[model samples]
Target: MHPTLAYKWQCVFIQVGKFANEVFLLLPPYLPILAGSLSLELQVLNLAAAIVLIAGKAFWLKSGRITPTDFLATLDAYIGGGTANQVRVAILEAFKDGIGGIGTDEWKEAFTQLVLDNQMQTAEPLEDREHP
Candidate 1:
């Protein structure tokens, strides 16, 4: 379940991370210890890295005038063929370039949704949505 969307959808049993055998990376990212209790989840870390990878791919995908969605929909391969990896990569890439290249309209919309999800996790909407 998405964070801000949690208010709208409860009783969810979301793993909040990679579900498919394919992972964005072979190893988890390194993290520095923080003061107090501040910490970021491994899922979020993977997402950050994935966005960079997806953004680069989206740049090329759109240049070819092929939406990631369309490309992914046509994939016909088995697990050994890395089909799951393809879906994971293409979906994230598609999200970044649905309307424009990475960091454009689609990226903005997705970032907005992330903020909204964060707000849903709290009682009142966060006045400060910016990251520290």
Candidate 2:
């Protein structure tokens, strides 16, 4: 992995770890105490549900798998306004090269330009289109 991407991944992992730690700290002993005092089975059940949900989400993130929709969205964000055929070919080439073929600075500039252009285009009046 490129140093920048590796750094980004590390930052994400750190954030996830902190979140999990905070969640775990809030549970367990507290649930037992609260459940015992209230004599409520529902509190225990809710705690169990929360644990399962958090565990499943953590497992999925650890698996390092990207969903198709996520991949498509990433591609669209990076390749906006490029010709479809060219985009397809570029994607293939990128996979073959095992590195991002575009320079990071260039990609950043293109993304910024695309966002600015989109904002301007959206702000244009519908009447302006007919005039052109």
- Using lDDT as the measure, which candidate wins? 2
lDDT of 1 by residue, 1-132 (tens): 778788545423332133121222322221121111222332343244334433334334346443333222222111123423443344454443333344677566765554333221112222223212
TM-score of each: 0.22, 0.27
By TM-score, how accurate is candidate 1? 0.22
CA lDDT scores, all candidates in order: 0.34, 0.38
lDDT of 1: 0.34
Q: Candidate 2: list runs displaced more than 4 Å.
A: 29-49, 52-132
Model 1 residue 41 distance off true place after TM-score fit, in angstroms: 0.9
Q: Where does model 1 exceed 4 Å of error? A: 1-40, 64-132
Cα deviation of 127 in candidate 1 (Å)? 43
Give Cα distance to truth, residue 80, candidate 2, Å.
Answer: 45
